[model samples]
Target: MTWRWLLLLISLTACQGPDQGDPYRPYLRVADKDDVPTLDPARGYDTASWQFEDLIFETLVDYNDEGQIIGELAQQWKAEANGTRFVFRLRDDAMFSHGRQVTAEDVRFAITRVLAPETGSPGRDFFLSVRGARTCDKPGCEVAGLVTLDNKTLVVEVEQPDPLFLHKMALPFASAVPPEIIVREGENFDFRPVGTGPFLLAERVAGQRLVLKPNPYYRGAVQPRLPGIVRFVGVPEDLAWMRYRAGLLDLAIIPPAEIPIVLRDPKLSRLLRTADTLRTQYVGLNCARPPFTDVRVRQAMNYAIDRRKLIAILHHRASPPQGIVPPTMPGYPQRPEPYPFDPPRALKLLQAAGLGGGFQATLWLRNDETAIRVAQSLQQDWERVGVRVRLKPVAWGPFLDAVRHNPNIDMFLLGWEADFPDPSNFLEVLFHSRQIGANNHTYYSNPVVDALLEQAASTTEPAQRTELYLLAEQRILDDAPWVLLYHPRTMLLSSDRLRGLRLHAWRPPRLAQLWFAEEKTEE
Candidate 1:
C-alpha cells in the first residue's frame, strides 16, 4: 500500500511538473481545478471545465478577463435595420486545429446543438430566448433564431427588441463549433475536441490529465507565453499544495481556509496573493417538491439560516447575499433588511404554512471538506427552527448527477460565478421555469420574475437593464426561491516566482496570462 501510494504521488508530481518541451518558455503553474466532467461545451456546467473552455474555445465575440467585449473568431459585426437581424463576420484567416477556416455554418451548428432538446444542453435556456430557438429542439433550427447567410456572416433574430444580444453573443455557448468533428464523431468528438482558440486540445487521459498546446493559427497579438498547459485532476487540496511546494506544480489554488497558512510562510508569502471577485454561493431550495414547494416554507427556511455565521465560518471570505444578484451587481438595489436570522420568525412562517413543529427534510451538498462544513452548519441552524435536516453529502460528480436526476431535495448548496457580467446569467438561468431538469436544480418558477428577467435581457440600455434586474432580484428574494447565502471572495496563492496571477477584469484568474520569473544561479 505504501509503495502504491508512493507511485501515485510520483505520478501526480510528473503530471503537474513543468514540461521539458520548451525550456525557454515558462508554463504557468495552476492547480488542476478538478476532474473535467466533459468537453462538449453544451453538455456539462463545471467551473473547472469552463476554465479550460475559456481558452480552448471562443465565441464570435469575447469578454476579456475584465468582462469587456473583445473579438475572438468574429472580427467585426453589424445589426440589420430592424434590430432583429444580426450579422457577424468571421476573420478570413480563422482556422480550426484541423486547419479548416471557421464558417457561419459552424456557428449555426453549435447554436442549434445547444438549443436541441436531444443534446440536453445546460445552456439551452439562455439561447432559447432567441427567436425560434425552441423550434430547433423539436424538429430543426432551420427557421429558428439563426441563419447561415454566408460562410463568413451568420445572423440571428430575437422574438423581441434585444440590443444586448450582441453582448450575450460574446459568451461561450454562442461560440462557433468545429462542425466536422462534432458531426462526424458525436460523443466521441467530446474526447477529441477541435477549436479555433489560442490553445488547441493536445491530449486527454480520463481521470488523469489534459494538455493544451498553442494553436499554430492563433490570431492574437500577444502569443501565449507557455508552449503548452498540462492539467492534472483529483489531486487532493492538501496534496496539491505540497506538490506545489515541492516544485512539482506551477500554480496552486489555495482554498479560503488555507490562504492564511500560505501567506504566513516566508517562501510562500511572495507567491501567495488574493484574487477578489463577486463569486456568489448559495443553497438552492428544491422548490419543485413538497415542503419547499410552499413559498412560505422556503421563506421560513431562508430566515432560519444565519448568513453571518456562514461568512464567519468561511473566514469572512464571503459577503452575505439577500438574493441571487449581489449589491456589487450593476442593477441590484440594496435591501435594507436581509432575511433576519431569527428562529422565532422562522417558526411563525412554518406554523403559518401549517407545519408548526417544522418538518423532516434532506439537504444536499457537494462532498468537499468545505462544502460539507457549510451543509453541517446549515443543518444545525435549521434545527433551531424545529426543522430536522438530513445532510446528504456526495462527491461533486455524483452530487450534481443526483440533483439533475431528480430535483426533489428540500435544499442543496450551489455556487455560481458570473458567466458574463450580466444579470440575466444570474436570474433567467436559475429561476426560469423552462430551465428545469438537469441544469435547473432549483426548480424555481414565477411568472412575474420570469417576465422581469426576460425584459432585462432584451433591454440594451444600461439603466433600463438595471431597473428590470432590480425588480427581478427583489421578487426572487421576497419569494425566497433559495436560501440566498453569500458572495465568495476568491483567494489565490502563487509562488513568488509567478507574476500576473491576479484575478482578471472578468472576475476569475486568466490562465493564459500567467508568467513565471527567471531563475537565478548560485554565486
Candidate 2:
C-alpha cells in the first residue's frame, strides 16, 4: 500500500473503537522521533533522555513558567563568599518515589558521581569549576567542594564565583538520585532509576513505549493532575503526525515539510502551537583550518547565504539571527543584520582574501530531512560565491561525535539550545579558547574574547556582565567563526482535549501542569 493509504487505514482503524470512551481521560499520550537511551541522570545528555528525566527526577532547583530559577527539592538556597560558596536547605517533605526521604547527601552523591572518572558522564565538564573537580579524577577521590552539612543542608564551593551556578544546578545532570539504588542495581541503575519527581516509571518496552504513573510520595506544591503519561518512542515525525490525526496521540511534533500544510488548514491550525525557543541554528566554520582560517573568507561565507530565503524555506518558523546569541536570551543586542546577503560583496571579500579561485570543502550535517534541505540551500548559495561545497550527512549520534572529535571537519550544520538563560552559556561555552575541544567545535580563539568572556562570567552585576558579553559577541561576529543562521521556533500540534500545555524556551515541557479538558456534550 502507498504511504498515504497506510496512514488513512491506521486512522480508520483507530476511530473504530467499540466504546466511545471519555475524550478527556487523565492520561496523556505523546510521540517523539527519538527514544530515551538511559534514565540515569548522570549519563543521559541528549534532549530525548532529558525530557523523560525531567518527569522521573527532581533537581535541587528548577525553572518556573517565567524561566526564573526556583526551589524544587531544595526549599531555599543562598550564595555566599562572592558567589563561590552556595548553601541549600532541602525541603523537609521531599521524598523519593520509592518512599525514601531525600537528603543533602543524595545531592552530594549525584554531583560527585558525575565528577567521578569511572562514571564517564558527559556532565563532567559542566562541573569542572567546582573546587577539586579538576583533580578529583580518581574513582574514590571526593569533590572537596561538595559537603553535606547535616541531612537537611548542602554546601557547595567553586573555584571561582560563577553567577550561573544555580542555573546549572537546575539541569537534569544535577538531579538527585538514591545512592542505595545505584549501589544495589549498579549498571542496571540506568534502566531502573528512582528519584524525587512527580512521576515514576511504571512500564518500559525497548524502542516502543514508556508509561509513567504519578508518584504518591511526591511532595512538591504542584501535584500531577494527570494520572499517568504514556509516551510512544522511536516513532518518526510523519508517523507521529498520522497517529495524532488518528486520535492516538495528544501531542505530536509537526514535521518541517508538513508545517505549511498544517498552518493552511483551518481545523489543524487551531491545534498548532508555536513558541520562540532560545536556540541558535548555525554552520560552524572550522577556524583552525584553511579557507575559513582567514577572517575575510569566513565573513564572505557568512554574507553569501540569504537568511531571509532560508527562513522562508522553513515556512517562516524562524527569525534570522543577528549574532551567535538568540534574541530571546538576555544581553542579546538589538542590531541590524551583520552579513546581509550580498553576492557581489561576498565574491569581493573572497578575492581580497586571495581565494577568488573557488575552493572545495565538505559541509557535515545530521542526516535529517530538514537538515538536508538547509544544507542544500547553503551549498547553492556558497557555490554562487566561488565556494564549492560537498555535503556529508551522518546520523545524529555519530554526527555529534564527528563534529567534536574529527579535526578534518571544515563546516557543519548544528543547533544549540540554551542549557540556561545566560549569555555566558552561549558566548563563553561556544567561543572561549578554554573550551577548544569541548563545545567550541570551530576552534575559534582570541585572547581578547577569552578575557571578556571570563570577565562576563565572573561579573555579578547584570548590566556590567551584559556589556562584557556584548563586547565579546561583537569581537566574535567580526571573526565570523560561524555562519549565524536563525533562531528556530518550536512547532507542535496539540489535541484540543489537552489543556495547560506550553513549550519552554530551555527546559522540557512541564508535564505535571498538563491535563485533559473535560469533553463537552451537545446540550
Candidate 3:
C-alpha cells in the first residue's frame, strides 16, 4: 500500500473506540452515505429508500437465494388465461405492524395507489401491463382488473400475457399498504407507513439517523434475530471508514481509494466481503441533442474509452461490460466486443460525422469522489480523440434532476441496478422508446427495438422470450445511446461481531437474517 494510505489507516486506528455505554446493545449499527428520501413504497426509487422500504414493507412475491420468484405475503398464486390472469392466496396469519390483518383489498389498494395519477409514482410504467391501468388516471378510480374475491384472495388481470408479471409483482412498488392507514394519514402516510414486514420504523431523525425495531406481527418464514437496526445516515465514505475502524459501525461500504489499503491489511481483509451485482455504470449520451444526434458520434464516444483502464481505476472491483444487460441476467449474449479501445477508429468516426475539428460538450456527474475520478479519466480519454469535454459535478439528487428534466444536459454518468432478474429490466426498460422520459434518459427511439421488446414481454415461452430480448439488446448496442463502462461488484466491510450478512445480487440485504454472534447462541 502507498505511504499516504498507510498513514491514513494508522491515524484512523489511533481514534477512540465506539461508545462503551452500548456495548451490550443488540442493534446492528451501519453507516450509510445518504438519507432516505422517502419510506413510502410508491415514492421510494433510490437505493437508500429501497433498503428501508424492503425492511418495513412486504411485497406479494420475493426472490429466493436461487433467483427464483417465491411467495411472500401471498402464500400461493396460480396463473390462468394463458398467463394473462393471476390469482393470489394471501397468508391468513399476515398482520400489519398497526395491528390490522393484511387482506386482499390492501393488496389491491397498494397497486392501484401506484397507478393513480395523483400518486405520481415513477413506477407506474412498470404496472402499465395491468388492465385498466392506462385509463385509471383520476383519483379514487377503481381498476377493473384488480379483484378482491375474499379477505385472503385477490385476482389480477393483464391486457396481454406477460411472462414477467410475477417478477414485477415482487418489486417494492407493489408492496401492500393498509387502505385504512392511507385514508387516515393521507399525505403524511409516507412518513407514518405501517406494513407487514420484519421491521418497523421506530424513529427517523431527518438527515441524522434512523432506528428500526422488529415487527411483533411479522409472520414471515424467517424471523428477525437482531433486536433492531440503526443506520447512521449522511455519513461520507471516508468518515464511514474511520468510524468503522473505531467500531462505531457494524458495516461500511469500502470506498474506491480505501479498497486497496483494506485488502493489504490482514485483519481488515478478513472482514471485507465482495459480490458481483447486477448493475451497469455508463455515460449516457443525449441522442436528442447535438453531436450525439448522429449515431456515428455515439459509437465514437463508446470506442474512445478503454474499459480495462477504467476497471483498473476501480481497483479491479468491476468487470468490463459486454453490453447494457449485465452478465448475471439470463439472455445476456456473449458476443464479441462491440467497441474496443481504438482512438483512431473513434477519431475517424467523428470526422465522418462532420466533427473532425472536435466539438466541446459538458459531462454532468455526481460530485462523489469516485464519480469525479471516473469522469476525469473519461475527460482525459476523450481529449485524446479530439473531443474537448467539460465536467460538471453536482450532488446526487440535483444531478438526477438535471439529467431527467434539463434538456440541455449533453452527457451524464449514471448507473442502473436490475429491479428484476430479467434481461427486459436492462434492455426494454432502458432502450424502449416508451421509456424515454422515465428510465431511458437518453431519449433513444427505435421502432424495431420497441417491437422486439413488446414481443418478448408477451411471449410466455422462456426460450422465445430470450431470443427476442437478445435481438432487442443487439439493436440497442448498435444504437449506442450509452458509452458502456463497467459492471461494479459490491464491496463492504462487516464487523466480526455480525453474522448472516450476505450481499444479494439485485435486492437489498436481507436484514431479517442478520444476527450478532452473541445472539446466535440464544437462537
lDDT (10s digit) by residue, model 2, range 212-327: 99999998978888889888767666676776777777888777778878988999999887788889999999999998889999999988999988998888889988778888
Q: Model 3, poorest ten-residue lDDT window?
A: 16-25
| Model 3 TM-score, all chains together | 0.93
lDDT of 1 at 280: 70
Best by TM-score: 3
- Candidate 2 stretches with Cα past 4 Å from truth are 1-26, 138-140, 183-188, 203-206, 264-266, 352-355, 520-523
Q: Per-residue alpha-carbon lDDT of model 1 for 1-523, expressed as tens digits?
A: 2576567667756665544433422555454535677766767577766777767777888766566777778888877756877778888888787888888888888888887888877777767657777677532357566887788988777777766677777666776677668878888867887887778888788767788888887775446777677777666666676667556677776655766676677777776556445457887887878888898998898889898998888887777775676656645566654687888889989999999977898888876667877888898998898899898876666777787776556678888877666677777777777677746677877899888887777677888888888788788888887787787776666665666776753444667776566778558
Worst 10-residue stretch by lDDT in candidate 2?
16-25
Q: At residue 101, what lDDT does model 1 achieve?
A: 82
Show model 1 residue runs off by greater than 4 Å: 1-29, 137-141, 263-269, 457-461, 505-507, 521-523
Better of 2 and 3 by lDDT: 3
Per-model TM-score on C-alpha atoms: 0.89, 0.89, 0.93
Q: List the residue pairs that clash in candidate 3.
A: none
Model 2 lDDT, residue 94, Cα: 93
At residue 195, candidate 2 shows an lDDT of 90
